[model samples]
Target: MPYDVEKPDEQWRAELSPSEYAVLRQAATEPAFTGEYTDTRTEGVYSCRACGAELFTSGTKFESHCGWPSFYDPKDTDAVELVEDRSHGMVRTEVRCARCGSHLGHVFEGEGYPTPTDQRYCINSISLRLQPTDG
Candidate 1:
């Protein structure tokens, strides 16, 4: 799919670090429980690390104890794109930044989390840039 912030592979590689490119461009998953945002509770907006597009907010973040950071919803309905993922012998919803089409992570549902959407957006920390709000 075409993205609003389309760039050549060479440019993306030059812009993002090795690990960031691996997750954002190559759809690689970071090791669970090792992400920076896994236990972060700061109030802020989490933007896509690759394109600076706001994808989530601290208000929607919740502790699902799922290792990675979890959000009940995106900042806006169109802020992300969910695609059916059938890799690694399983089916799941893969989340990507709508603006840049960079991989954020996967979203899960029906696990009985007491959230308004009943969905868990398990995102990678390296895929996000948290902008903490001033008190």
Candidate 2:
């Protein structure tokens, strides 16, 4: 699928930090419990760090103690894209920013979460930038 914001490899590298580029572009996972938003409870929207596309919101975020920021749903149905990941000798659903195709994280389901959706969108903090809502 073609993305709304597409850029060359060099451009992406130049824009994102080393760690951000790894998770957002190379599909690498950050260390568990080490992300900036793992325990964030502020009211805001989380947008894709690479392209500023809104992906998840604070309303959908929950504490799963899984080390990464977890959300039961995205800000919108079309805000993200899921792909079948067969890497690391296992199968999982990988999530990406729909607008830029930057790797966000993985989504899991059927774990018995107490949210409207039983799904969990485990996203990398480096892949996101939080915009706090003002009163």
Candidate 3:
């Protein structure tokens, strides 16, 4: 799919760190419980690290103990784009930033989480840049 912010491969590599590039650009996963936002509770807006597009808000975040920062919903319906992932011998939904198409992570549904949507947007923290709300 086409994205609003399109950068060349070289530019993306230069802009993002090694880990960030691996996840955001190459669709790689970070180690469980190792992300900066994995256990964070600070109120903020989580934006795409690559394009600065607002993806999820702290209000939608929930503790799913899935090793990544999980959100029940995106900040807006158009904030993300979901694609079918059929890797690792399983079918799952992959979430990407709508603005840049950078891979954020995967979203799982029907697992009986207490969230209103029952959907867990298990996102990689390296894929996000949190902007804390003003006190």
Regions of candidate 1 where Cα sits further than 4 Å from its true position: none
Model 1 accuracy (lDDT, Cα): 0.98
lDDT of 3 by residue, 1-135 (tens): 788999999999999999999999999999999999999999999999999999999999999998999999999999999999999999999999999999999999999999999999999999999999999
Summarize candidate 2's per-residue lDDT along 1-135 as a digit string, tens digits: 788999999999999999999999999999999999999999999999999999999999999999999999999999999999999999999999999999999999999989899999999998999999999
Please give the clash total of every predicted structure, in order: 0, 0, 0
**CA shift of 99, model 3, Å:** 0.5
Candidate 1 backbone overlaps, count: 0
TM-score of each: 0.98, 0.99, 0.99
Structure candidate 2, residue pairs in collision: none
Q: Clashing residue pairs, candidate 3? A: none
Relative to the true structure, how large is the alpha-carbon lDDT of every model? 0.98, 0.97, 0.96
